[model samples]
Target: MLQNTLEVSVVKNLDFIESGVHICVVANQVVPNLAPILDRNLKAKRVVLVHTADFLQKAKDLASAYSNYQVKTEFFKIQSAFDIVSLRKDMQRLFNFYAEQKPLINITGGTKIISLTMFEKAKEYELPVYYVNTDDSLSWLVPDVESVYHLEDRVKIKPFLTANGFEVVVNELPSSNKLLRQVLDDLIANIDGYKEAISQLNYYAYTASSSLKSVSLSENVEGLRKLVGLFAETGLMKIENNKLIFKDEDARFFANGGWLEEYLFHQIKQLGSKIPKIQDNLCAVEVCKKTNSVKNEIDNMLLCNNNLYLIECKTKRFSKDQSPEGGVSSAIYKLDTLMRELGGTFARGMIVSIFELSKADYARAKQYNIKIVSLSELKDIKRHLTSWLS
Candidate 1:
């Protein structure tokens, strides 16, 4: 209960100013450095990012985020990440320039040597020092202040991504249609009943999208009629004269395994309501990294407890027997890379599949530290999500 459950209030006696605060942050992970600026009560005027050469572009991206938040940013580059003597010289110069400004230092980021150098220099100069923890607490460690304050959840999806050197070029928010939600609930409740039918529907949907806007099923497949009727009730599809007619490409996409994406996005929103720390969520987001032109489309992304959760909803069927180029393994690899690239160490990646995978694929997901929630888990999704958030 140190800080995670301490989203209570600000410190009472030790009052902080609302302006003229200059914080020099050890820039490695970006969010910790941006915390103080996001707190309106602190009202940071400028932020001096102290980063190594490797993190130069990330630091610049963080500067852009500061500019977006109306806080100016400066840079202090270190020549070496681990060389203590070189880092001390650089820290000395940074401290000399920032001394007159009475700037503070945050040791929440950077390598251990860098943080140690910055901390020792701040103590020598008798300047204030701070550190941010994952639990959303700002600790004032200088002069044995022993004070910690809970940070407000003021971060948005766009700025958070921007600070991490990624840009949200295109985003589409989820629509909470009652009928669509009902269809999802029905599918989950009757998961076993619709498994085979949904698989056939996926095939037909994919074939239709590849060829025509519709498909004529000559044979009345078992349970397909009922499943199509559920989708038709949600206005997602219709059966006309032994044919499954999709409204458009979007409708076809939904029919062809896109429903799981829609389902998971809404499920996260529902989880957000019960979990107060859940902040922002977006589905169908296309983000690109600024340093390199690498692009990735996120099926669903949620901000909870100051951490981004990247979720990939897959309705693609997985085989019981293993193959070298299998669906689940590929999904695991993609989720692992995207999570590390976009969210760094502060993010969690999850793959929610409508079908379970083989033991080898499950082990592969575990190796990559990706969470897998499949059909059985989806039955008690809220409970599973609660455990996940915990």
Candidate 2:
């Protein structure tokens, strides 16, 4: 019989006791079923078995089995519904019992509610909760536990004394790595299409601008409207208050400085002889100050040739740091006003940006026939001009 499998040895130890000796027994049995011992330990006290909604029937079955073992077990039903009221009520009842008897074995394996409720109640009563699972294929218990045993078909055990806050080690858990990789690969593949679309749109905008001999501000605005419309149709950009607002996800590539400058230069050079060329050292002056108050410190101005091409470059960065937008905008406004005051002697008006232009800005620039280039396409303009000069 199972009882004979154990060898029990009793020893009497007499320390400094006056007239009594304590007897201690060491038993080597088929992993001495602690269920019976634990039940006896809670003899006259309240022993509540907190169960989740999903495993309520299973817990009841386990309690019935324990009855045969002559252990007194009381079933405490805990609901695991998404409803907040029911969950709160269940927590209240569990906390009340925890304050009274302070259970030894708190099982939480079936549902999230069990873990959530037990986690709160365990802190109040300082109770030791054990996760009992029917699945033996994997060990659900956390490490640091003293010992574990298999009871019939169910996995049972008492964990080591854990602190109030314990974090689960998810790295060791089994997961679908292959599926995750496949999903990531598919996402990257789809993003390539957006990149290509933006490239085509940039090319079209640049080519259209370079083909113009000398455009007025009104004509420039019209051109921008056409470009913005194209972007909206192709879903690369959206129109908001005459401005091209990039969808958040696609904003990064559209704001690429290198690409914008290259496209701008390419289109400008394509203009050929339509744009007049003043002498190389003709003093190309850039007025970078705002229009309202003229900072007549002419020495601070960046000098170019008499064929001065004033460009206002705009862009937005993720940081709060000062971007080129404010400086560039202020510079353009002041220069334009200054040139107008000087009887339109300036060669040309231009606006360059690392960002897509808004409908209003685009229209404003077009109305002045201001040439625009993206930051990325800037290098291409110089290269195109070099070829023209060659």
Candidate 3:
């Protein structure tokens, strides 16, 4: 189930035959699962969607957008998707009505109960049964058709997110350049206690509404003055009346908000470029749920050879005695959950840390299947990243 490119290839092979009705199972995961049926070119005369009451309208609206194909889409609701008995009866009745067009049932969406019931009816009526197995490409369940198809660059970020559950999406990432890498390297080299320094700098700016209003760096705080002194050398800070002032708006924003994220974005984009044939690459993507209640941000993400990589960048020091909700522990949880929701089991997770980690923290990251890139590796960033991603 939920095959992206494999489904498209199967539809392409079935193009020679007369137009037939495609009965697609609709569940909450309609975008990626249903996209292969609707977006691709098929000799589908009409698409009959078997969906639950809540998502019935969404399916209809999605189908209506396909005016170029001139195919009709109808929605038949199942009062309760959990009720297998009623679902079978609806499928039987639809089969009787569209028996002449020879509809093909694609059991890639919906719950297991829906699929099993339809599959049983498919057997009883001796209708064609096909499934797209993302694990092993598209497979024929009933017809026993043995063929493997190769597809590339089929899944895009926007449609996949739109169908999954996101309502608001913004991804406008810039291309990687050597200048970014140089700046990041300079930050690490020129600054002492770089991670803690940036953390304190960020914390100071974060407490203010805007960087135009300067935050004072206490000379008594042991490392705060040194950090401010280093940043001042790079023109990121200005010393005025014994107070540390951000030189420009960019400095204020990055120092307070997403400096680490922006740094890793450029660094990873540069590393990913060295690899050949990456399907997609993006950074600093922000998305929100349907009601715009919860918003999730991805520092960097890339698709390669059917695997989606989710990366998180952190500039804070990890505490050995901190609670589970503490820095490193929470980051591990965030990366793992994002990978599971966005790319399922096949997706990968990584954490690129500007700070060093203890042995226990490294093991914790490993337990969550999160690869780590520590500050020491920044000198040979490309090599370390290549080995990890490869």
- Per-residue lDDT tens digits of candidate 2, residues 119-143? 5554444433344332211121221
Pairs in steric clash, model 1: none
For residue 74, model 1's alpha carbon misses the true position, in angstroms, by 1.4
lDDT of 3 by residue, 1-390 (tens): 322122222332643334467788776444334434543543456778877878865575446433334667777677667787787788778667765676777787788888888888766665566676664255556554557433333455554455455543767455344554465567766444566667777677765445455566666555666665545545666657766677666667666635666666666666655775355667778877664577888877776655578888766666655577876888898888888777666677888777777777789888877888777766666676677667
- Give each model a TM-score: 0.88, 0.24, 0.72
Best by lDDT: 1
User: Per-prediction RMSD in angstroms?
Assistant: 5.4, 28.5, 6.2
Off by over 4 Å in 2: 1-47, 52-56, 81-85, 132-390
Residue 62, model 3: lDDT of 47
Tell me the whole-model lDDT of each prediction, alpha carbons only: 0.76, 0.35, 0.65
Comparison by TM-score, 1 against 2, better one: 1
The alpha-carbon lDDT assigned to residue 86 of candidate 2 equals: 77
